[model samples]
Target chain A: MPNKNLVGIFDSDEKMLHAAQKAKDLGLSASDAYTPFPIHGIDEILELKPSILPKVCFFGGATGLLTAFTLQYWVHAVYWPMNIGGKSFTAYPAMVPICFELTVLFAGVSTFFAFLFLRGMHPFKTSPFWGLQTENNKFALVFDLESESKAEKVSSLLNQEGALEIREIIE
Target chain B: MTTATASSEILRPPLVEGGKTYGQITDDICAPMEKRPPLGWFVAFTVAGLALLWGVIMVTDLIWTGVGTWGLNKTVSWGFAITDFVFWVGIGHAGTLISAILLLFRQKWRTAINRSAEAMTIFAVMCAGLNPLLHMGRIWRGLYWLFPYYPNTMGPLFVNFRSPLLWDVFAVSTYLTISLLFWYMGLLPDLATAAAHAKGAIRRFIFRTLSLGWSGSARTWRNHEKASLLLAGLATPLVLSVHTVVSMDFACAIVPGWHSTIFPPFFVAGAIFSGFAMVLTLLTLSREFLGFKDYITLKHIDAMAKVTLLTSMIVSMAYLTETLIGWYSANTFERFYFINAATGPYRYCYWTQMLCNVVAPQFFWFKKFRRSPVVAFIISIFINIGMWLERFNIIVIGLHRDFLTSSWTMYHPTYVDWGLLIGLFGLFFTCFLLFSRSLPMIAMSEIKHVLSSEKHGEKQHA
Candidate 1:
């Protein structure tokens, strides 16, 4: 917990957006923010890339399709064929509904896990500032404390940009 | 910028009333959970609990005594059990439509009601799951057979690939899994907020664990939004496919009333129709009792009424088409079956359905009924009753009189059948009550997005 990071709190997202932009404009590196809800421009303000979740979901759905079809066919047609209702063993039309369901099922499950894994999140731990209500009415900007010189300048910049509260956090 | 835009703006208020802050929204939604239940809540909970207990007893009786406890006979093998299953499944549809479909459509008002509706969908599906489980007299063995495990070890004779019933098993289980994940993903951030705000250590710890250490970081939020959007995209087709498969269980059958090409679309429309009605019914009571008027708003109620009206019309048209096709096809059994649905033993049910579902929702077309929660709530109840009878008439009426006149017989539900059917309401309400207390009843994050514009505008003006 000895590593310190500078944090500034704001009441509204607009102020956070302004402070982040001003800090970035000033050539100060401010990379992290916490908000009660997503501010539309915060991701771009911090210059984060678009998430890769959709592509992951697409692959998940493809895998699901392959798995669903193969299982249905293998069980019904290849393993032990049956002649019920005088229909063919594969019964591909009847299998279509389950296949469609599985495709969705796989995509949803994979995307959820991808979301958690990529975010470096797990249920067993909490954020360093979990007690500060960043996910409620207020917003917080978390910046690196690379050095005392860099940290103090960012702290003063946050104050100048009307940060409601500024605190130093040991991480 | 334009006069038309200005006029429309004047005609409607902003989506959320009171200009509620994120803090205020949390307070409004979460305060009830911390306090003792109101007198009405106590009474409602007690009654629902009793009904649930009664249902449990009846289901136990059904299990111990066998499936014969109800009233399934030689011809009418699927009775109230399947009818109730379909009805409950249909009641779950509006949740997805509001959460997934409306999310895709960018309907912001959905934020106010989607949480409760989705929870309702899960609960309804739970209640729906019961009948099929109980319908299998040997559930211990039957469920074992329904699920796949080491399929190569099990013979093909064990399961039929062509059966619609088999398809239903896959469709419903998948629907439930996706739905639970979707609901939980939306809940994570809110739970984190609740954990941060919570007083007790244990409560905070519990909420924190459930929240999965959500810090609402910009990067995390960006990924969260993408994942949610993708899930919504996946769920939209799934919601439709689940009911379509459910309909195929009947349509794929060779029975006169059951085998119709039109069943898929008709059932989908009907499922959504009944689902919206249930959503309205629960929301009307919850919004009033929970004091979410500013959040839920009159516009949400009115817009929901419009959906109900539209879906009801589609359902009515489907009903008419079925009847018309029966008479037009010159199929004696189909014609007689449709006719007997109106004139035979279950004619009361058929007429009641016509009154409640088709005729009752017509009032929503008028602006006054659409605006009044009392009137709307009452009508929603009627639509619910009507929808149940509609399923009843479809299932029971169709089976009561099979093709051969000599074999035809009237199927009446015993007291046990009535008990279990009525009791499902208890289970649904109980789950909802527990949900209302334990979680943010509205999608707080989404609603905050709607407030962001106003907050930003006011900031600039300052």
Candidate 2:
């Protein structure tokens, strides 16, 4: 869609934070900002929406509880039921542990998978702009390059915003 | 230094040394894996690997020759193998508590130790998972029947839905899954960092896939923190429930020593105690060898010692209460179970348990002893030994002298049992060694996220 992507790198979090604000104000069409650690309030600065992972956890947990109950009911009450130790045929008291466990199992694992699905984690993949410093010490903000004129404008604006480096990201 | 300290900067020890930057923290924590691993890594890995090999051979032989290789008999049917099962599972508890419970409590000191501790929980549970299977007599179907949906071929009846043993299957598997999810969810950001630092394309690719293309975007962080907190909430109850179910395995039975209302809390405390000891043992050695003293500071060790001290006291009270309740209940069988445990053939186990679990941790009350990592390490090893004996006393001692005098038998572990126990250590250490070298063993982003707060604490301490 563009000639080449432009990436602005910043060494300090403060500079990166302010630079994102500046780039947004300057209307540079920024999409991604990568940092070593999470910067507080940066999501608001990046104009991204809030995540929906909590809903995933909630539904997953409910499903888990129902699954546990259903599995126990199928085994104990409906299919091939038998008496043991003179106890009741359906063991509600005994099912609580499995119920709790499955609730946790379903909620934790499903939420993690949902997270990966949302985040684009899959086998045999590489991060788009993975460099030695990017995920460790440096922060990067990537923008699309529209044209040679726009690329020059992006570069000068990044420089003015106190970016450490501006590079043309071919991939 | 004293002049700076005089100006209202009271000298409270900081959990993280205050001067570290985000980059320095990353480089320092990842250094063991990034650089050529030190000589200590080789020594530990080689030794642990050989030991793990021994364990694997022993387990294979066990499966091939049948469970008869163990010293278990009808009188003490669930001997060392079940004990080892409970032992390893108990040892797995501290990691989740530190990562989930302590995180929920907002203890920042957890950052330095949570990664390795959670790794310990996973590996310890893996070892624990093996014991029940090995204990199952049928070689071809070792505990496969225990699976609720394993397809009962010959029977009109399903597997026992009411059995505590069945509950164990759900509990342990759930514990493992949640621990893994929590651990992996925590690792995503750090894995991205490792991938970025990785030299070869293969290393980069592997870590990148594992990291799920994490770019540490603020939105991603928001999701990650939310997901992690929710998982922590889910895991907190689990850390309590898993062990409670494990305790129910013994308590649900009618045996004199095994049946008690207090068993759940007792086992939970003991599990945390043993788990923390194992964490301390591993982290002490890791910090010394990996040059992480600055990150895994004396404060971290001291805080762990305090936990060790608190749990040990609770455990000792549990021991006393078991005997006290037995005495007050005026039940002869229950009273004799306690008496026999303390004064019978296994008095050695009882005394050593009292010494190591109850007495040894008392040393932590001294600030000097708790602050010294070497001392903490030694005390932790003693706690490990004591906790294993605690399991032995509970499982074997009670089972050996059950109700009928005619059925009484002293259970001694065969060479296979001992080999398997020692071999699991190798298995655990080897996994840890590989982990320490292969992954970012510390939560770099989480630590850096708190750097400002740590700095504020340092300013107060200066």
Candidate 3:
């Protein structure tokens, strides 16, 4: 059985990245990473797959297109449709421009609202993480703590790689 | 390192900060401010501001009394208000179009004038919005427009989906909101940059709050870029929709001159044409004043000139097409309207528009004239004046000569209209002058991009 509790940290990107590769080479478990700026090879280091955001966007957009089409169709075509200027009651062709517009609008609004929900954004609220250094200068990497012995070794390794500062964040 | 390098390699210069000193750039850019007397500038701005205040007083009085103070008789209901409305709205286009549209297209030349142009858009929209409310005698019912409420409803009334005027309300409001957001979002990174330079607590706090804790991190930059791109994309369609709806106000009408298929494309081209010209005028003056020659280079001037020419040509084509169509439609009313436009009592306005919009833009074909800021400035002024008259001709002339020859009375502007017109200038410049003093008149990041991109090109060419 494998222990999922063990996590490691290193001083700089290059070192932590090097260590992560070495850990993977040694067949160790890695969970996640947190950085001020998204480091390019970080996902590979964590062995995470690409985000499903693009797929989500595609689905959301398609749903929006369908919704726009259906809504316009129902109002203009099906329910209480009036004959004006001897034209078709549905006027499907004229609906294209507005349908296209509404499709974009729905997709955009949905994507935005979903992102806010997923990120846990709320009106009149502070963010979940409130590190002062996060506003400006510093980058932080959080890793799961295992045994007391493993924590000590991790601290030593980070220090060896020129970590300017380090502290245990037990939450 | 070999002694013999490729021509491109040789031509490519390194970006050494020491190449041009800040002092030199400051001296070059800030020369206009230094040359003028601060006292005179202060006095001039004060007078203009006072004039704007007079217009405000008139508006307040109008709100208190009614819209009857103006000479808007039943037939000439739109007169100055609608003309000014279209004028201000048209003026609003250049700023966002230059900032967001140009940004999306990766036009590096937009850097110098974008800040000023965006400011113009906001102020022009502000000025544009006031006219409709003022035109509405019962200003208290202005909120009705927002909620789609009508005369009988306690709550908002159902919006008239068919009326172009109603559509105008939605389209313009959306445009203004999106434009404001776009402008403010772009300003954020720069505001953060400015905030970092702040020394006082108050300034720092305000800047930080406005900047939303931005620090130019790569992540923030990426997100910001994505947000800006999204906004630009949204705004481009919004910009089109706004003026399209405005043109629909005329197209949707049954009047002979007003009812035309060409009005939408015509109005849009004219709006962009006039807007760019106004932008050119202000930016030309701004670069001269602020000493931002390096940022707003000769290349920017030339690019603007070319656009000015293109739009002017489009506008001219629209005019020609309208006239030809009028003749072809063989509607006696339409023929009379176009004939009146050419040889009517307001023929001066028509000819002036022709010379300015149609003829003046031709000079831009000359590279020397295009590059000359002074020439561009002069041409831009003429374009602004020409567009105002175009609106005037469209509204006043087209309607004044009603089908009933008995009712055909020559309509001229009253003192109130003239006062309001001049007052608008005061309003426009007051905001512009303030923008020049406070914000960086150039898009700094965009300028940096231009420099770097050109540096790459230089390397290849060397």
Candidate 4:
């Protein structure tokens, strides 16, 4: 028999969640669960690690702060210092607004790109379940199976858990 | 006890009416984009296009001739253009407020409105950004000077870090970029839905590219949620800072009416007030034209009207405080500025502002008015006009009668000034119409998420 991935399609997120949990309890690892919208707590069942994007955002903001201060200090004070209203070259108060703006800009932009990178999402990339209604109302749970016996067992478990349809794609 | 429980359930209305399923909701929102646009959209687009054309001509003429083509005088150097800029920027705050702050607060009602409101914010910023560039008179030559890029021959001059105008440059640009990112991030899942529903290859290709191959995988959704929350957190403070920096443009000046400490909060309140008004206007019209009454319902209008009412009261208090502080200061120039604002040659403008902004929104206190789309729409228009006049009173009136009596002069906007102002509205509407026709005006994914939770809540209650 050819290697294949089994997909169990369900009508609602709740049914899909229950099936994923049951599959986990049965020691059958799910490759992925796809839904029209996010199912909260599904990650715990899937055993996915929490994303570290917040840390990325913090570091990005730090870099922006350093860049803003260095650029302002170097250009205004060191590069071409001019006496305006007798203010000091450092003018730390004047530096605060740009620093705040740059911090947010960098932090926000980095977090967005990092999330896309971590998720492996970009233009023209295609999902394995392309044209499936998984993006609509349907919820799909995909699993890899090589043996007919394993496929039958997984199919019975999904059918018992209210899967509307069972399909397999050959690798 | 059962009766009480039943009544409480009845009192809590459904956020998404008609008990829409996920598939039905998708069809309702995306169907319009798939079909030919309605007659009203075509008419509105044509009108807006003409207006944008008029504005383009005015801008071209002003650039070719000079800033002198404007009605600006020696005393009133900042005239209609500055007022338009501030008005549009303030109008933008409502969008970010709805999208970022409401999202942070977990106000689900924002799902119906946030997408369009965020679009409005971006467009309003576009409209606001244009005035300054046009006012520069030589935009192509001077535009690069605004940034602090080094390795330039002209002394490698740096922008004035102390200047609030420079702060404004950073703040507004940052606000626009963040707003656009936040908006597009929200659009991704919905774009995927649109792509899935698309029949034609061109439509599918366009949405597929924009959606960046989004699959509703659990891991990605988790990360998307976290990223959106983080963005909303960043945007909340960024939105406030944008208006605060804009306020500093005037507050930093020593001019009597403009130099008040209350300017920042007052300006922020006014910005929201005007913004919600503009939102009401656009939402009401879109509800009628686009047939989205089921989604953008009376409850949404009522919630927005309450916000408008709250901000209006804050704005009125600021006006009173400004007058009080002016009197309490006992300074000749300060006291005269207040008195002149109320009773001088520009008193008509001041009273008109008070009527439209302060008096009109007061009707929202009555449930009859707050819930009525017509009342809300009319008051929104008034607030828009009133907010524009508020900027005019601050900028022109404050400068016209400064310390030097010889420099005092009356200001009148030339035809080009009027053309540009009218033309901007045309541009705003044209962009909005195109957006409504092409994209899902409502957030389909968010609404579906909310609907599922709502169903779960019902199950628990039962």
Backbone clashes under 3 angstroms, per model: 0, 0, 7, 0
lDDT of 2 by residue, B1-462 (tens): 555545424555555685787788888887888788888788888899888888888888887898788888889988778888999999899999999999898887899899999999999999998888777767466344677664667456566767888888888998999999999999988998887777889887888888877877656777788889889999999989989999999999999899999999999999999999998999999899998988898888889999999999999999888889999999999999998998999999999989999999999999999999999999999999999999999998889888899999988888889889988989889988999998889999878766744443334210
Off by over 4 Å in 2: A2-6, A22-30, A142-157, A168-171, B1-13, B452-462
Question: What CA RMSD would candidate 3 show?
Answer: 6.8
Interface root mean square deviation for model 1, in Å?
Answer: 2.4
**Of models 3 and 4, which has the larger lDDT?**
4
| Ten residues in sequence with the least summed lDDT for candidate 3 chain B | B14-23
Tens digits of per-residue lDDT for model 3, B375-411: 9999999999999989888888778886788777766
Candidate 4 chain B worst ten-residue window by lDDT: B453-462
Q: What's model 2's lDDT at B45?
A: 85
- Candidate ranking under DockQ, highest first, comes to 1, 4, 2, 3
Model 3 lDDT at residue B321 = 92
- Against the reference, the lDDT scores of all candidates come to 0.87, 0.85, 0.66, 0.90
Error of 4 at A26 (Å): 1.8
lDDT of 4 at B215: 89
lDDT of 4 by residue, A5-108 (tens): 99999999888888888998998878788888888768888888888988998998899899989988888889889888898889898899999999999999
Best by lDDT: 4
Better of 1 and 3 by DockQ: 1
Error of 4 at B235 (Å): 0.3
lDDT by residue for model 1 (B1-462), tens: 356546545664687899788898877777777677788888889999999999999988998999998888988888889999999999988999999999898777788899999999999999998889889987877755687666435453446656788888888888888889899899988888788777789998998899988989889888998898898898899989888989999998878899999999999999999999999999999889988899888789999999999999999999889999999999999999888988898889999999998899999989998999999999999999999988888888888798878878878799899889978989999999989888888888778877885544322210
